[model samples]
Target chain A: MMPIAITDPDDPRIEPYRAVRERDLVGRQHRFIVEGEVVLRVLLQQSRFDIESLLLAENRIDSLSNALENLPPNVPVYTANRQVMDAIVGFPIHRGILAMARRAPLPPVEDFLATLPQEALIVGLVGLANHDNVGGIFRNAAAFGAQGILLDQESCDPLYRKAVRVSVGGALIVPFTRVASANAMVRALQGASFEILAFSPAGQEILSQVKPARRTALLLGAEGPGLPPDLLAQTRTVSIPMSGGFDSLNVATTSGIALHHLKSQRS
Target chain B: MMPIAITDPDDPRIEPYRAVRERDLVGRQHRFIVEGEVVLRVLLQQSRFDIESLLLAENRIDSLSNALENLPPNVPVYTANRQVMDAIVGFPIHRGILAMARRAPLPPVEDFLATLPQEALIVGLVGLANHDNVGGIFRNAAAFGAQGILLDQESCDPLYRKAVRVSVGGALIVPFTRVASANAMVRALQGASFEILAFSPAGQEILSQVKPARRTALLLGAEGPGLPPDLLAQTRTVSIPMSGGFDSLNVATTSGIALHHLKSQRS
Candidate 1:
């Protein structure tokens, strides 16, 4: 694919990349931005999302040549000097590489669950409004081989720019769907014969001692509020043994530890 | 203690809190700033560091009255309206609470290690320059009851403002010291009879299978470069089992998992 040079910051061809940060506040309109060389590579090589175009700093073009060559010719590669690139993005483009991709329509929750293997490990996130936490959990989920993920309506989008970057592109790899509420998520998982395990500080079972069933779902909530009382009461709740007064483990880190234990515990 | 009102942004008495973001580029001269109600409560309640003063938006003063009652009269509490506070700090202080504290001199590495209990768990960080990662790791270390932390020369300061905030006061609660290099940190831990376990993608032992000694130190490096080869060769290396082409777990998440596993495996 020949790299096209973009000289003007207001170039209409790159409208989607303009005022990137401000646009993040409103919605991406079924489109999302991926930044840096690592995530850009994942978008081109492995992501299920369709690549709309790439905006790269002049300096990044040479290094990205090998990866760019494999792109389908239909995908346009746009290049801009540092000044224009920064002006277009409305921020200093430190990573110097950004890609805009079309987000695939989210699959229905029941269909996503039905597709999972008989013995599967899944993750459910409720009221986790932080993108970093959602992203980090997806990273852990992918690392530990969790088959799928479910997010409640209140949780932040994992495809947000920072979350995707923090996950190191794990959001692109994980298959996930959103549900109406925490209760809805639990009902779907239980209907699929998946054992639901929610993490809470007041959890009755210690994380180390709990043996998960073949099909299991690990549920997590925001740091301060944690998993809600109703959800915790409904599921087999588990807790990591913490020091006397310190119960604040970043929710993402909590997921990483819990997922690792569950993955290793399977016979 | 009465709260002193300051209307001007350039008040010399509130100098330490001025242009907070820019000042972070330079050093704080043996002082650090903590933010928000939760961390403020921790600073006043449990921290060994001495309070220098506090800067609060007028609205926060009432909520913080209970915490301020116990403060030493010598420590000043300054309050300003939101506009003045924003101008003084060169940004909107969303949490509207800030505290400046004097940093006690970091004890010598060996002397600090000598103070730990006979059975201790410590975390050693190398080349982790990100504030969020450092803070998240400290949160994990504290949650899992790791008694102390050691940072190599290349690692970022755990006391950096963003790190301190991300740690949820773990940076203040956990005692940490910096060493000359990764090798120096490993040598000190080994000298103190800590069976050092360095995490690497190319590690020899699975993290789940490794039984830790009574005096254990979990060594972690930045996500990409990981631990230096020489340091990895010297220490008993371990790795979390990752999925087939995906080995990227955030450095902080990795530390959380490794520390939790080691802590649980102990008697």
Candidate 2:
């Protein structure tokens, strides 16, 4: 790895490493940022992504030097003082490491679906805005062996820095694709002969009672206001049986539980 | 409700709500500081806890005045400017509403056990430090009809601000008690004639294959490093069957799925 010294926060070369507030993350040119050692390590290990550059505080260089040695010799490693790093990052405390990696190209939805096995469990996120929950769902989807995660356009970026950190790097491993609209995605999946199962708190059939189909697509909405009626009408609704007095589970937790149940039944 | 005008952040009258960061919330003295209108409304509905005081920003007073009208006439409401509120609260962004309430007393272990039916599924937290996961577990526990929650002393405080918020006030309603230690808690449950089961990724029996018992206590630990070996040895180990490539589910999500499985079998 080539080490470059950066004495100023305003250094033009460190633009990619600048503080990522809400707006900066949404722009078309710059998608998202990745922070901390674990997530960076995962990104490096994955052959899919092209890491732009690495930034580390001068004090942290010695400690992380061994890990940095694994990077390709051509990759640039930028070093800055703790104060300069803190100023540029906006957050006073990060895990002493940051990496800018280009978002990997998502496979075409049609091509992605074609690669799955006869029986596949796919988690579809619709209008969910929480990054942590999105990351958690991805982590759970991977853990339960879901085919892939499908995200709607309005949903928060799954590659957001916080999402990557919260998922404990699972976001890097899981296969995901962004769909233009929930309706369009549902139509596409159905056209591919997939059974679209919408998870709802007020559904007619208990989740356990639903038999596993050949290709299952589980639809999960945001926490507070669940799947829109029009969206629910597009798919079969299934409810997880809960004891009396409890209303619902966290969206991410609910998705994880449902994925686990669906995987066990199918297997 | 009695309205008190406070121009100072260090007033002795509002000391209970001051320096909440430095104070230890474990003992009986301090209660969790709940912010935001939605959560406060939920707490007000619960008759078990005593409302210490209510603080509202000056601008928000008009909108909240009508809602405050329903509060007891003797309840004190503090009104302050944004700057004063920020100075007292330590955080610049105040959510317009804050409430300090007395923590409800927990029932003795024996008394709590007496209330549970013979066939019960209960969740116990052992050294789980994350407040969000703790709150999520409580929400999941309640949703799946777990009789109660047992928390080891080392576990994060359930009444902390983030935990309460993340739980959507479910922590206030869920029945929970802190045990001195995981070992003692396991022994206590055994003495009560309950089957103690610890969730492990490497467990021999899948959750579906394990025969449901009349009374079962599900033990869960923190994420990453799951249930400790000694804890796992003392109890029956069960695994949530996953597909070939996946590793493990989030601790809270796992609990929800396992609780649902256990409850479904009983029903």
Candidate 3:
């Protein structure tokens, strides 16, 4: 289980991982950093993504030996001491493991829609830019059997490092693609014969009253100002009935509740 | 709506709001910090609590005139320049609003229960060390009309600064009490004639199939290691049916699903 040893902090081999906080924000070459052992394992197992390389702190290599077995010899594994690891990453490296991963773009929205079965459950996001919220929604969508997720261009990147980790790597496994706008996203789902349900505090129809359709999409918006008036007017509005005068639930929490209600595979 | 001007950062009048990030962590006395203008307005309007004072950044003062009209003349309002505010708060003070408020200790758990109606809904938490989870649960509880929230000894304080802000003031409004341990919390709920349903991934019954009871409590645990096996044994178990082979949703997200399903009010 020998790994390539890098004694110098400035080694060119580990350049992708330098100053992770800022460098990741820059996000070059269609590749992203993956943190922690859980997300790394997902990247290794998911065929759609390729691992560029792996960097592990010297102390963590022995513990992660079993996990490294499946790595093809072609995938370089670089090991660095604590000092070099910290110097390379601009911060204290607590997780002690990192991987550079690149994902091929998912199928076009139309092709993705064509692949889903008739009795599909999908989640659509509009104007959501928070990484944690995007990640949390993807995680919930996976837990409740969502066939796919659709996002507007304004939606934050699901492959962003923080979003991927927060999702527990659900983003890596779950299928999702972003459209031009929420209006177009809704239109595409409707065109595919999916019943689009826009959720809002003012929604007239109660959740329990509406029956799940063969093809369904739960549309959610960012917190504060919810779905646009034009969008809400065009779709069937379903509200999760709440105590009078209380603020709406957090968007991710709202998605979880909505997904649980319309789950087609509830056994 | 004139406010008292604070020319110096070291003024004792705004002492409660000084060195806020660290001072808030220390949490001297019974008071807690509330940030953001929206939360500040909630503090002003909530009759259940008392305001010790207010500290507003100079630029934000004019915008908040209408909100300050109801404040009694005796309540001190301190206004400071942005630089002074930033220095005093140990951060940039972006939200530009802060409040000092205090609450008398809540009625003991038994007396609080005695006030509840026969059909009250409650949420019980065990070993939740994350403040965000605790606060997010309270927000969901409030939205769903839960009458009370119960926490075990290990759960973090809901009034902690980050928790309070994350909750969007739901923690200020929702009634909660802490018990000795998970066992004692369960016993108290059961003794009060509330049906205690512990949520677990391995539970036999699906979420929607379980009928909401007149008086019910949904029990949740920390994210990684869930409710203790002994606790799960004593109570009926309910599971949010998931797509097989995916990770469990975030603890906060899970609570939202369970709470929505068990929501007693449908109107």
Which DockQ values do the candidates obtain, in the order shown?
A: 0.78, 0.62, 0.76
TM-scores for every candidate against the unseen true structure: 0.94, 0.86, 0.95
RMSD of each: 2.1, 3.6, 1.9
What TM-score does the first chain of candidate 2 have?
A: 0.89
lDDT per residue as tens, model 1, A1-267: 788899999899999999998999987878999999888887777677888899999899999999887688899999999999999999998989999998989888998999999989999999989987888898888798888889999999989988898788889988899999998998889899999889988889999898889899999999888888988878898888898687568888888999899889983
In model 1, pairs of residues that clash are none
Model 2 Cα displacement at A111 (Å)?
3.6
For residue B63, what is the lDDT in candidate 1?
Answer: 85
Clashing pairs in 3: none
DockQ measured for candidate 3: 0.76
Off by over 4 Å in 2: A1-15, A20-32, A56-94, A245-247, B1-15, B19-30, B52-94, B241-247
Candidate 3 Cα errors over 4 Å, as ranges: A264-267, B264-267
Task: Quote the lDDT for B59 in model 3.
Answer: 87
What is the number of residue pairs that collide in model 3? 0
**How much is B178 displaced in model 2, in angstroms?**
1.6
Would you list the rank order by TM-score, best first?
Answer: 3, 1, 2
Relative to the real complex, the DockQ score for model 1 comes to: 0.78
Pick by TM-score: which candidate is best?
Answer: 3
